[model samples]
Target: MLKTLTKTLLCVSLLATFPAMAAPDGDMAPSDKQLAELYWQGQESLKKSDWSGALERFRRLETSLRRTEPASADAAIYWQAYALLQAKRSTEAKATLEKLKRDYPDSRWSKEAESLMRQTQGRPNVASESSGNDDDLAEIAITGLMQAPPERALPILRKVLQGSHSIEVKKRALFVLSQLDEDAALAELGNVATTSNDAELRAEAIRMLGISGEDTAIERLRTIYAASKSSEEKRGIIQAWMIADKPDLVMQAARSETDEVLRKAAIQALGAMDASKELRQLFDSEKSLENRKSILQALGVAGDTRSLVGIAASNESEDIRIEAIEALGIADDDDSGENLVRIYQAASSPKIREAALQGMLISDDSDSMLKLYKQASSKEEKQALLRMLTLTGSDATLDLIEAELDKAGKQP
Candidate 1:
């Protein structure tokens, strides 16, 4: 009896395979390579970010193969389902997956097909396939930090940071905490800074505290700045100290700072502060060219044009010169346009040369920039000037640029 039953099952399974083949006598089924080719074309479309194109390709591939070999359509079907899922056509992907399981349960694509069906339009309301990593999903949740009102996710992240979680979880939570400035997150980070023995956690807290700028965090940084012997920790302190609004501390950080990078950051921060005699003094006197560049960039954050002439005349490192050129735009002084032109006269380095040209566009009109464009020697410099001019698109400017190109024996 057992042998008879087994024979009957084999006969049925074999019979099931014959009908589809006999119906399509005149039509040649696509070869395996053809099917693979179609599958990849769809994948490429998806890769190019054209989800709809990928879906269309998959559908054609599926239909062409299904007539003679329904099972051969598994990859096409899976890709179709994936493209649909990516296109936010969650309902369609789920339905396609269901059909896949029903028609070809034993196929190689069955596992992913069944799993996707469960994920998208499942009872749990999770509409789509998931990344397998727990940390990824948690990080996706943690993106609530970028949501319009950040107060929502603050408490949950605080718990994750303080609680015993995996390092990945803590890392992602810290990232979200960095985004959030809620009283709760700030309070939790402050408490952690004071109490936690974990150096990494304390560092993370200090980083966030800089953004929050609470008095407690400031005091904590002050203590760390004074007592910590580690160079790395002091760098972190200077990094934090730069973000504060206290102008005096910024000058203190810049004038008497120890580390090169920390001093640069301090000078940058002081430049950002209200330009008192102290900030001006540091900008003029700081010996390092890099530190001076930092000071110039900070001056940008303060939005003052007073330092433009001094920065333009420095004749120091090209980097500092380039930074000063960019700072003219931040200063928003169209009145200083002529100064920028004269500065670029002596500016020979490629970066500073281009920056000075771009700065003129913001502070000078196209007509004024046309004269400078004539003075530009190489194609690269001319290209940069033309690009900036194109952004402004003034007719008078175009006319002047044409005249200059004619003079240079070049075409506009």
Candidate 2:
């Protein structure tokens, strides 16, 4: 039975790849042998700590691959950022790292970029000599301090946190201190979160406090959020609450916050928590069309597809209904595809019909769509259905259309 099941699964997997065979040639990703060779040469330069040489190679590779090999370009950008860090070009390195994380978030290279970001952001180069041993020693010292008992480590870490060490070293100390259970450690982190001059260091402190998840740490975050005049600081505090899974605090902020952008951030955080009930309640009570749209988006984020369908069905404003219809697609509401088709049939507005058709395509209701195409009375409606099928890249639907066209050709 197991062998039969395995064979069945293998056949199914191969069958799934058939759609790609019918897809347009534009779907193919171009490959370059020269780019691969140059990438390895850059890696060799990095291995030798030849920062300038590596930076030059990676920059050229990134320019070459940006359009043809986006994934490779993302990697090249990450390596370029690392090379910049190693070359003591701090500002450009930080910018490049941020770009990598923003543009290709799902790329494996983003993980390495995040690590380099933490090390390079606020910290100046503290290695007096361009020696690998010095770099090794700094890391080892931080690790050794963290491994020691709080009684032994606290004094050293306290000095490091307060001292004019490089930003990277201070960040390491803050992280280790956050992990410690000592009251003094929490106090130091709280102090840094509240008082640090460097915005990046303060954000890092807020992050560590949130990870600690101590009641006192949370209170500090709240206090900082309430007291800080800077919008950036408040945004950081909200993000820290998100990381700590404090949805209640986020919801509270969403309700009370005056800044439109920050309020949206809180709502997004609630959405990330799967707070469907809260989002749905907000959707019902919201008066502003903009806020209602946000609630629909949040419900989609929380995977509350049922609520989205109801909103799409009943919302009076065609524009709002269109937004909700798209949200249904985001929630992957396969069952709602027919509802979208119904909306399309009823909608007099071109944009609303377009939105409904787009939703159906996203839900992969190609079988229903093919039936709809057959039932269409007018040439315009039939043309619309054919365009939608092409947009969806439905191989079976395409085959059906091709057969119909061939039959027409033979008849003429």
Which digits, one per residue and each the tens of the lDDT, describe model 2 over residues 1-412? 1113244233222221110011121221124434554675776677566789999998988887985676657878877888888788888999998888888887766556667788686566575465556556765797687668999998888787777777777777777777787777888899999888876678778877776777888899999999988776777687678666688888878888888777777787777678888787666666778777777767766778788777777746877888888766556655677677787788778888878776666556677678788899998988888887875557888797898799889994
Worst 10 residues of 2 by lDDT: 16-25
Q: Spell out the clash pairs found in candidate 1.
A: 120-128
Best by TM-score: 2
Q: Which regions of candidate 2 are displaced past 4 Å?
A: 1-136, 333-351, 361-377, 392-412
Q: What lDDT does each candidate get?
A: 0.63, 0.72
How far is 105's C-alpha from truth in model 1 (Å)?
50
The RMSD (Cα, Å) of candidate 1 is: 22.1
**Candidate 2: RMSD over Cα atoms?**
13.6
Question: Candidate 1: where are CA atoms >4 Å away?
Answer: 1-159, 166-191, 194-200, 229-232, 272-278, 310-330, 341-367, 371-412
Scored by Cα lDDT, where does model 1 land?
A: 0.63
